[model samples]
Structures are given as structure tokens and as C-alpha cells.
Target: MTTSPNAPMTSPTRRDITAETGLPYVPPGTIPAPASAYDGLPRDTAVAGDRGWDRDSELSQMSKAVIATVFGLALLIAAFAVIGRLGGWAADYGTILVYLAFFLWMSIAGRVFWWGADTLIAEIRKKSNTGDCR
Candidate 1:
């Protein structure tokens, strides 16, 4: 909060920062926001900031893959049971089980990919900011 002697300090508080920038102050190390803080904004929660679509797309893809794998396994199991009872399909059981296992493995792989991507992006951001020294 220090300013050069030649520079005039007009605003002194978080309220003043909000008034000047139209951005609210979120306390450090907290995620859940109280209702009173977001009363008049368009959304129920405050925006943390934007990370661009590459990050967003990776996250979305990971979520969709996980959900698809879970539901796909359930559907395959049900289909196998029905086929085994109605029409003899014992020959296909081993293959379907393998596919289900592969999908589950893919879900875990997707998680690891997302984690690595996030870590790389964060490191890049940190390096870029660290370069802007006085």
C-alpha cells in the first residue's frame, strides 16, 4: 500500500478499489462466498477471473469423459444381462468386460491429463508474472 511521494493516494480501502475498478475483493484462502456480497450482480457468485478457453475446454472434456464412462459401463452391464437371459451372448461377455475396463482406465487417464495440463499452465503463468520484476 505504499506510494511514491510525487503520487497522490486518493483511495485507501477495499471499498475504494471496488468503486474504482468495479471489481470486488475476495479474502485470501476462501472459496465460498456469502449471499450478501453477490446481491446485485448478474450471477450468484463472484467470478474468480478468466483463464481462456483452452483451460475451460480441457476441463469440460474431462468432465464429459468421466460421466460418459460411468453411464456407459452401467448401460453395457445392463445390455449384457439382458442379452445373456434373452439371447445367448456368452461369447461376447469377455469382450464387453474388456471394453468397460478400458473405459474406466480412460477416465483415470483423463484425470491425469487434466492435472498435468493444469500444473503446466500454472507454471507458465507463474513464470510470466515473475518476469515482470522492478
Candidate 2:
């Protein structure tokens, strides 16, 4: 493992490091393989933060938004149906208004939900002291 002082240093491969140290070698600038069964588990449930937890949280939030939007649409339909039965301007133009309102509501609600999820994740990471904010 010794080199001449005048020799140029070259990047070492994983195999070279492994052979020299007799241990598992991880390449530079790469995450190492987990050392134990509990590695990479969620911080709340385990000793360290899960590297993919943010991705899972995002997917969960998207599914929730979809479900909420669907439920909102159903309720809007039911309300519009009841109002349209009253035989007023509602019956004539309420469909367009309802669609517009639904879109607006979805945008606002989705943004809020996403923001809240991000904030919660950030707070959890902060409290756990397991994530590098940078």
C-alpha cells in the first residue's frame, strides 16, 4: 500500500481498496451498502433516516390528493344535482361554475397539502438529526 513520494496518486478502485484493507470497499462519492438489517429504516421507526423516505412521502401525498379530489368531485356533483333541480339559473350555468370552482379548489388544496407534507418531513428530519439539510 506504500508508494514512492514522487509517484502520482491515482484514484483507487473498490477492488484495490478491498484487497488492501481486507474489508468491503466503497467507491468515492458513493453511498456505502448498509451494514445491518436495521440500516436505512425510517428514523421514527429505526436508528437512521430512510434514504427513500421523501420519495415515498411524495407518492403518498399524491395518492391522498387524488383521493381527496375524487371525493370533492363526487360531492360537487351531488350538490349541483340538488341545486339544479330547483329550476333556476343554477340549472343553466351551474355546471360551468362548478367545474371552475372545482379546479380552483383542487389547485389550492393540492398546494396546501404538498406544502404541509414537505414541512412535516423537514421537521421530522430536523428533530431526528439524521438528514443533511444541505
Candidate 3:
């Protein structure tokens, strides 16, 4: 069988309104037929990053973050203690230096915590919303 090049293309459509998108529904196996390239096999898995849920990538990202945070906090604590001791060695500067160091440490640490919390919340929201309408 051969279709003339000038013949109009047509397919049977469904009656559904698709309440959400409000677009005319296309019957399954009709419009936009699947291609052999994207039949969801090993070939498709090669584009793993696009899928956004690979375990190894996520593990590496999380581990890097955890290690960096631990290292940073360790440095911060050591600096704080060293500065505190130096401040104590000076009689008149002790209270003032302690207060300044405390403020500085808390301010920077608090902002980092806030940003991490916000990112965590956003990631949680994104994870929870993975293609789920509700």
C-alpha cells in the first residue's frame, strides 16, 4: 500500500478533555507514536543525568557536602578556641574580644545554616514533587 505525498494525514482522536491541561486528548498508539530510540531500554539509560535520580551521583554530591561541612566546622572551632585564648591572655580585651569572636562565628555560621536549610527545603520539595500532580 502507498499513500500519495499529497494526501492529508489523519488519525482517530479521543473525546477526553484532559481536565488538567484542557487539551484535546489523543488516543493511545495514535498521535505522537513512540520511536524505537526511546523505548526505555539500556540505550535510554545512557542519558542518566537527564533523569535526575541516579543513586551514585546523589551519593557523591551528598558526601562531598558532608565532608566539606565537617572540615569547615572543625577549622571554625579551632579558630574560635585560639582566638578565645588570645583574648583571655589580655586583661582589658578579654570580654570585648570574646564577644566579637562569638558574634562573628555565629553570624557566619548562622547564615550558612540558613542557606543550607533553604536548599534542603527546596530539594525536599523538588523530590516530593517529582512528576506528581498532587
Those runs of model 3 whose alpha carbons end farther than 4 Å from true positions after fitting are 1-92, 131-134
Residue 44 in model 3: shift from native, Å?
A: 22
lDDT of each: 0.58, 0.62, 0.61
**TM-score between model 1 and native:** 0.29
Off by more than 4 A, model 2 = 1-92, 130-134
| Lowest-sum lDDT 10-residue window in model 1 | 83-92
- Give the RMSD in angstroms, all C-alphas superposed, for model 1: 24.2
Q: How accurate is candidate 1 locally (lDDT)?
A: 0.58
- Candidate 3 or 1, higher TM-score: 3
Cα TM-score per model = 0.29, 0.29, 0.34
Tens-digit lDDT string for candidate 1 (1-134): 87889997575689877888898887677877567644676643435673334442455543554555565566555555555343233345666775666567556655555555565566567767899433
| Ranking of all candidate structures by their TM-score, best first | 3, 2, 1
Instruction: List pairs with backbone clashes in candidate 2.
Output: none
* Pairs clashing within candidate 3: none
Query: lDDT of model 2 at residue 118?
Result: 64
For residues 11-116, what per-residue lDDT tens digits would candidate 3 score against the true structure? Answer: 5345434665678776567877558644667642766446545665556433444554565566567666776465555566676766776678767765555555
Residue 11's lDDT within candidate 2 is: 90
Using TM-score as the measure, which candidate wins? 3
